[model samples]
Target: MRCHKLVAYSVSAAAMVTLVAAGDAWEIKSQNKLVKHCANREGYDVCNIVLDISDTHALCSVCRLNRTIPDLAKPENRLRWSKLEQAKRRLLIGLMDLHLPLEAPVRGYSRGLCFDFLEDQRSNSDVAQKFITTGHRDGVITINILEADDVQRVWQREHVGERYRTLLGHMRHEVGHYYFELIVSDREGFGQIFGDVDTAYEKALKNYYARGPLPGWEQSHISAYASAHPAEDWAECFAHYLHMADTLETATAHRLIEQFSEQGDFEQLLLLWDRFSASLNEVNRSLGLSDAYPFVITPIVKNKLRFIHSAIARYVGLQL
Candidate 1:
C-alpha cells in the first residue's frame, strides 16, 4: 500500500495513558493483560482501541504502523485526538463489514486495510505550519487531525453545505477511493458497468480540479466532492450505497422496517432501499432536517450500484 508523504507530531512530549472502568463499558483484549475500552459513541465498536490506558498511547494491533501521531500536548488537543481515534475505529469497522479486500500494495498486498490519523499546523496553534490536506491514496488513508475538533468540522460542514458530516463519513468516502482500485483495477464485470477506468485517471482528475465539475452536476453527482474526479464520483456513490444499506439493515433488524426478501438479492435490496429511503426522508423532515439519503437514482447510477453489489457478492461467494 502506498503511504502518504506527510507526518504528524505532538507539540509536547507524550503523556502516559491511564485506564479505569468507570461503569458499564465495552472492552477488548490487547496483547498485554490490559483491556482497551470503546469510547461508546454511536457508530463505534469496541475492537477499535489503539491502546489500553496502562500502555500510554501504545499502538494497538491495528494502529501499529503509524509513523506519526499529532501532537496532543495542548489540553484541548488531547480531547480532540481521543474523539478522532474513536471515529477512525468506527470507520474501519464499517469497511470490514463491507468485506472489501485489504493489504498494502507492497506489504500486506494480499489483504489488509490501513490508515494514518494525523494532525498538521492548521489545527495546532503551537505548530508553525499553515495548511493540511485530507484525502486517501494507495493503501493508506490519511485524515487531518483537525477534523476531530467540532468547531473546525462544523465550519467546513457549513462552508461545504453538506447535509451530513461525521468522522465516519470521511472514512467511508476514502474507502470508496480504495475500492475503486479494488473493483476498477481488477474486477472484469465491474469494468463493463463502471466503464474503462483505465481512461487516464490522473489527467481526468487534473481536469476536474482545474475546470470544476460539469454543469448540472447536482442532477447526477451525490455530492460536490464527487465532481472533483471520476474516481471520487465512484467513491462517493459507493459510500452512499453503504450508508443506505447498512442503516436500512439495522432498521429491518430492529423491526423498524419490514424484512427484505429472503433471497436478499441485489434487485430485492434496491426495492427495499427505495421504499426505506423515502420513509427515511420523511422522518428527517419531521425533525426539521434534510433527507437522510439525499440523491436521486438515475438508471445509470443504479447500474453502477448494482455492479458494486454484484462484486461484493462474488467476493464473499454469496449467491445473488
Candidate 2:
C-alpha cells in the first residue's frame, strides 16, 4: 500500500524501523478488511516478514501480499512460517524475473493478490477449520501451513502417489492458476490448446480420485493430477514452464549452459533444460537420491509447455 513515511516499531525484534511508506506497490488489504502494515510479520527471519525495504517502504513486494499469517506465539508456527516464506519468495522471484503482471489491484492490476498461511484442525487441533486445501481463488492464495513440515508433506505425497511434491512446487502450481485467470482465461486459442476450463471441476475431481487419471496420463499431461481438470492441466503446465525458467536462470548464473542461455528463445530453453535436467538427475543418482526431475515431457506435453511459454512471452510483449 502506498503511504507517506511513518515510523513503526517491531515488538518481536525489539527494534525500530524508521519512516516507512513508498512507491513500491502492494497493499495489505484482505478480502474482508484493509490491513495496512498490520501483520505480526512472523514468517522467515530473512523473508523480510515486515518487508522493510527502506525508510520509505515498509514491505517487500512479496511480503506485502500476505493477508493472514500464522500465530507467532507458537514457536512451531514461527518455524513453519519461515519455510513457507522461503518457498514463496522463490516463486515470486520467478514471476518478477519473467516480468509477469504482479501488481496489486490498487496499482491497476485486474485483481488483487494476497496470501493466507493458515492452520486447520487437521494440522492444529484448536483451529476452526477441519481441513485447508492449498489453492488460489479470487486472487487469494491459501496455503495450509502443515505443508511446511517435511514429514507431513512427504506422507501426503506418498499417500497420493505423487512423483514430486514440495512447498516450492505447491507455490508454483497455485500461482499458475492465478496467472491463468488473468492472462489465458479469456484468450483465443486457449480452449483449442489446453481444453475447456468450464467443465464441472467438482465432479471431475471426484471421478479422478475414484478412478485415477486417464489411462497413460503421462502420454500427454505433465502430471497425473492435471488430468483432473482443464484448469489443473494448464496450471501443471504453467508450473513446469516456471520450473524451466527458474532452473535455467540458476544454471546460467553458475556458468552451466551459460552459452545456451538466451532470454525469449523458448526452443533453446527446452533444449538446454533437457540437457541440464538429465545431468541434474544423474548427479542426484550419484548421491543415491531420487531423480531431481521425475516426469518425462512427451511431445504433447512439450507442446503444452510451449504454449505456456508463448503465452507468457506474449503477456510480456516478448516475441517467440
Candidate 3:
C-alpha cells in the first residue's frame, strides 16, 4: 500500500492546490497537487523545489485539464499516470510554444482541450470496456494508462506493425486530430492533398482493420495507419510536423545546431529535419538500438506536411 502526505496551500486570486481527498471541501482547487502534494505554491513543504515555482504561479495550467486519473491504489498505476502526465505536459507545452490554440472548447467548437487518463477491463475487471483506445473527441484526448507500460506498449506496437510509436507520438497523433478539427474547415488544398475527408469513419476504419491499409501506403501516407482514413493521414502528417518542430527546437536549445528557425522557410525546416533525423538515427545505431526514425517522408507526404505547415503559420499569424 502507498500513502501520500496532504498539504494545504492558498494563493489569493491566482490559484491554490489543496491536497486532500476528492469530494472534500477543497477539491478541484488548482492542479498538479491533485496527484502529489506539490502545488508549486508558497508556504508548502514542496514549494520552490524548482526554479519554475513562484508565488504568482500555483497549480500548473497543464494539470488543470485532467478530467480523470488512474486508480492510485495500485503503485504501478501511479507511475503510469506520472508517465502520461509527463508526455502530456510536453505535448501541451509544445503546442502553446507554437502559439496554437490550447483553450478547451466553451461552446460547440474546438477552442479548448482536456485530457482523460483512463483504464479499462484490461487493468480492472469492473471497468466499462475491454480496451481503451487513445483518441480525441470534442477536444478531450483519452489515453489508455496501459500505453505507459513499455512492455505492453511495445507488444501492441509490434502486433499492429507500427514503425514508430511512443508516448509522445501518441499524444502528438491524437492532438493532431484535435487540431485538425480546429485548423481545417472547408479549407482549400486540404482535399487536394489528403484526398476525401467525407468518408464514413466507421466503415473506413472497419475495412482498414479487416484488410489492413492498402499496398503502397508508404508512397503516399506517413505511415501505414495513416492510410486508414483521410483524417488519420492529416493527423500523421501533423504529428510529423510537430516532431520536426520540437526536435529542431531541442537541437538548437542544446547547441546541436546553431541555425534553426520556425519562421518563413518551411523548406529550410524540412532540410534541417532530414539532416537531424539522419544524425539521430545514426546515434541510435551506434547504441545498437533501432533507428529513431524509420519511415521516409515521400513527396506526397511532404505535400501534406506542407499544407500543415501553412495552416500552422496561418494559425499562428494570418499569413498566406
Candidate 4:
C-alpha cells in the first residue's frame, strides 16, 4: 500500500492544555513529571505522555507486542532490552507510518506479529541455550539480546563479513520475513519475483554456507546473505525497501528534501535516494565512521525492491 504522508502537528502548551480537558486525553510531558506518565521504553519524548486512563502506566501499543523480555534480575539485561526496544519501536513506527496492519499474535489473526527478546549462553550463562539465531517463525520474531551490544555485534559482523550490521537492521530484516508470510506466501506470481520458496530451506542454507554467495553476487542480490535462498532474497530486498522508505521520510521531515511522497514516481524516489545516500555516506566518512548503508542497488535488486513496494501497496489497499 502506498504510505500516507505524515501530517505535521504543531502543539503549543496551550493546545496541549486544551486537549487535556478533564485529563482524558494523552499529553506529551516531561520525564520529570512526577505525577504519572506513560513513557515509551525508547527514550522518545514524543511518545512519552500522560494518559487519562485508569491504567496510565500501561505499556504502549508497540511495547505490548513483546512476548518475552530478558530477565531483568540481571542489571545488564535491562539495558540490552532497552536497546532492542528502541530498534523495534523504529521498525513499528515505519510500519505504522505506512498504514500497515500490526495486530498482536494473541489476537488470533494468522498474520498477527509478536517478538521474543532472548539472551543465549553467550550473554547469560544461566540460559540453557548455547546459541540463538535471530529468525522468524510463524508470527514470532526471536532476537538475540546480544545484538544490542556494540562490541559483540561488531565482532559478529566482522566474523560474518558483513559490511553493516545493526539491531534495527535485524528487526527490519526479520519483519520482512514475517510480512512475506503475511503478504506474499500465498500470492500469485510470488515465485516469479523471488524464485521458488518450495526449495528446502535447510539444504539451501547448508549449501549457501558451504559455498558462500556466488561470484558476482552483487549483480543480482542486495547482499551476499540474500543469495542464500529465494526467501532470503525477498526478505533482504524488503528490508532495504523499509530502510529507504523510513530514511526518506525522516529526511523529508527534517526538510532535507523540499517534498517527499511515498506514492509518487518510484524512479524519482530512487534518484533522490541515490543522491541523499551518497551524501549521507560522505558525511559518515567525514566523521571517520563506516558508511551508513553499504550496499548498492543494481538493476536486479531494484526490481526486487519494486516488487516489495508493490506488495506493500496491495497489503495497504492502495491503488497504485
* Angstrom error at residue 160, model 4: 0.8
lDDT tens digits, residue span 1-320, model 4: 26542211111121222122224333334322222234552243334323334554555555668798888788787788878877887798788777667774422346578999988888888889999999998778999999989999999999989998999999889988777866663445778766888789999999989989978888989999998999899888888888998899999989998777776667877898898999999999999998998889998888888788777777667422
Q: lDDT by residue for model 3 over 1-320, one digit each (tens)?
A: 14554443332222223344654223434554333223533332223122123325445555567788788788788678878877876686578667787785433564478888989899888888898899999888899989999999999999999988899999999989888876775455798889888889999999999999989998988899999999999988888888889889889988998788776589998999999999999999999999998979988888888889888887668522
Better of 3 and 4 by lDDT: 3
TM-score of 4: 0.84
Instruction: Please tell me which predicted candidate would have the highest TM-score against the true structure.
Output: 4
RMSD values, in order shown: 9.7, 8.8, 7.5, 6.5
Q: lDDT tens string, model 2, 74-95? A: 8898889889888887787788
Per-residue CA lDDT of model 1 for 1-320, tens digit only, reads 16532122111112223333434322222222334442322223223343444654434554553445566456665676567666665555455556554455522244445667676666565665566666776666777877877888889889866766777778788877776655543456655655455678778777876777768767656777666655677777788777766676578768987785322687878878888889989999999987877778777778777777765666545422
Candidate 2 has what TM-score? 0.82
* Segments of candidate 1 deviating more than 4 angstroms: 1-67, 101-111, 125-129, 185-192, 201-203, 260-263, 318-320
Q: Where does model 4 exceed 4 Å of error? A: 1-36, 39-50, 54-57, 104-111, 185-188, 318-320
Each model's number of backbone clashes?
A: 8, 5, 5, 2
On the 0 to 100 scale, the lDDT of residue 18 in model 3 is: 35
TM-score attained by model 1: 0.71
- Indicate the residue-level lDDT of 11 in model 2: 27
Off by over 4 Å in 3: 1-58, 105-111
Which lDDT values do the candidates have, in the order given? Answer: 0.62, 0.76, 0.76, 0.75
